[model samples]
Target: MSSDDPLAAALAAAGLGGVQPGDTRPPEPRIEVVSDDPAEPTGPRELWPEGIGTGVGSLPGTDPREASALVTGETPEFPAFPELPARGVGADMIGRTAGLLVDLAVEVVPTGWRVTARTGRDLRRARDLLAGDLDAFDDACDRIRPHWVKIQVAGPWTLAASVELASGHRVLTDRGAVREFAASLGEGLRAHVAEVAERTGATVVVQLDEPGLPAVIAGSLSTASGYGTVRAVRAPDAQDLLRDLISGIAAPVVVHCCADRPPIRLLAGAGAAAVAIDATRPAFTGTTAEPRALDAIGETWDEGVPLLLGLLPGTAPEREPAIGDLARAGYDLADRLGFDRRRLARLAVPTPACGLAGATPDWARRALTLSRELGKAFADPDE
Candidate 1:
């Protein structure tokens, strides 16, 4: 039946309709909490590498070695591969992900990177920068043999939205291109994770950055000409592509979206081992939390999935809050959701509310330090 059909509309309103034949909607996810009982065979507990806190990637610097060393020193238990977008062009999100496209090449344009017919200078530079960063990361690991390390990349939807096709439209505008890009990214990420593991002797966790996802899903992205909005991708299509990408990576996947209304259920359904969100974001604060956001959080926790709660500000505040003050909101949220405060320690990890690239170097360091303290607060709020 058509979406306009009265019955179809009614069914959709009831949350039981709108699915047509050959629909790609994934099976409704089962939301059972994995037993917290120690005797039960539980999944890995190091979702954020247990008891540690880390950055949201992108430090403020041009030196990969220095950036990596700082991250290793600060978040030794869960250090993330630092990204330096200040290096320009090839170092930004789209350029970085484009470097991982196997067989496909992209070149920088005034608007952004656009697909090219063959490998070229732009593509080579992007790949080289990534290689250099990895080497720097390896060197940092040599000094500090961390047990687990995280690497971030743009998620499929965000990548598709950021990179343009040869025709200049976004890759998200073409279903075929979206699938191909997802496959290539998956292949590349597997290789990337394997290499990190080999060099660091650490378990690798992959975080997919999807900051642009809410815009992509809401059809808020501008057209190539800036005259109209690009068509919004359906949630099922987005979830299927993400699931495919996640399945190909051999490491735990964390979907990080700083959007006010991240698609928490969609990310969880796509098999994300965890979802990262900015809990301190203004939208989630105040008298009434956004019902949908609250529901998503509750549902995500109900499924035994951990949340990387972005608790600390990316930049230093005029007056820094105490660890308890920084962590109070999350504790309050848990209570409001009817969860025991202890669950915060078991299923939550503290992080800076977002990336720190925009912050001064001093604030970046301070923010990371506070994040570690917040993790401790979660573990022992009374201390």
Candidate 2:
């Protein structure tokens, strides 16, 4: 269903937005919230981590040290959340998460802020949890009172890659299961978008999390249960599945990946309004391949996809990498890609490569502050 609104049509046609250059759009910071922190307590009492736009439950049994390792790639002291609670907390999850985002938006967006919430991983059983989750999310927004809101759910490919089959194998290997899962997820998302928009009176922005997407397409994720390592799923074919997911929402869609090698073209073709990525790690190798990254960046830029570049590190200050250091490391990639600093500026939205749930409270706050500062530096017309 094509939108009659020019902005919607333009965004849908191009599939993204380019960097706003020298154009002094005063920084209207919308607090974009992440899902799940494995290190914090999970009780209902709302606790907003410093610098985060909203509240989220801390993961159980995850040490601050171990969580830091997951984000920074250091030796692990503890394990990450193997599984999060997903059986019956649908409405509650929606409200808690939305309330959390609203909490953050109130602090960040001065003129007005967009509030959003993320539905946790356990989407395979979406059919069971969908309606309740949507209802709870809508109710939560009524309490928080936000202007714009986002709803996030795990994407199909990632879900297919991650979810276990009844046989204890991966669902990705079963085309039928994949299809069913995609349809269910799409249905849930459609209902979710409507509830969020109507209940919160917010412009709904649905972001699908696909951290495992690049690996899934690259055939990097193999079956640990001996289902013969999963094979690469083609993007053109996958686009149909993705299109269904995108089509369900009447609002703009953002496809976010923690992986370096995102399927940018497929996402662009699938009608994504933006492509959010973690650029903390290099996607391509040495200086020789910088051009490819630049070209990829340019293609997405030309297609109107804004690159949400992950810039902040989630670990402690000791573990965190400097932005200038990261920028220099990305210099060849940026230069080779043929993106002028200005173009890069327009295209980039710097952030931590992933969520800071693993970091200590101090680290999370610092990460947010650093991300904003780095974004300012990157956005400056002079630099």
Question: Model 1 misses residue 263 by how many Å?
Answer: 0.9
Poorest 10 consecutive residues by lDDT, candidate 2:
74-83
The digit string of per-residue lDDT tens for model 2 on 200-278 reads 6766666677778878778777775565678888877788888877887677787877765677777877888777766
lDDT of 1 by residue, 38-59 (tens): 7957565455445668889998
Question: How big is the positional error of residue 326 in model 2, measured in Å on the Cα after superposition?
Answer: 6.6
TM-score of each: 0.87, 0.60
Pick out the ten consecutive residues of candidate 1 with the lowest summed lDDT: 42-51
Give me candidate 1's TM-score against the actual structure: 0.87
Query: What C-alpha lDDT, on a 0 to 100 scale, does residue 22 get in candidate 1?
Result: 60
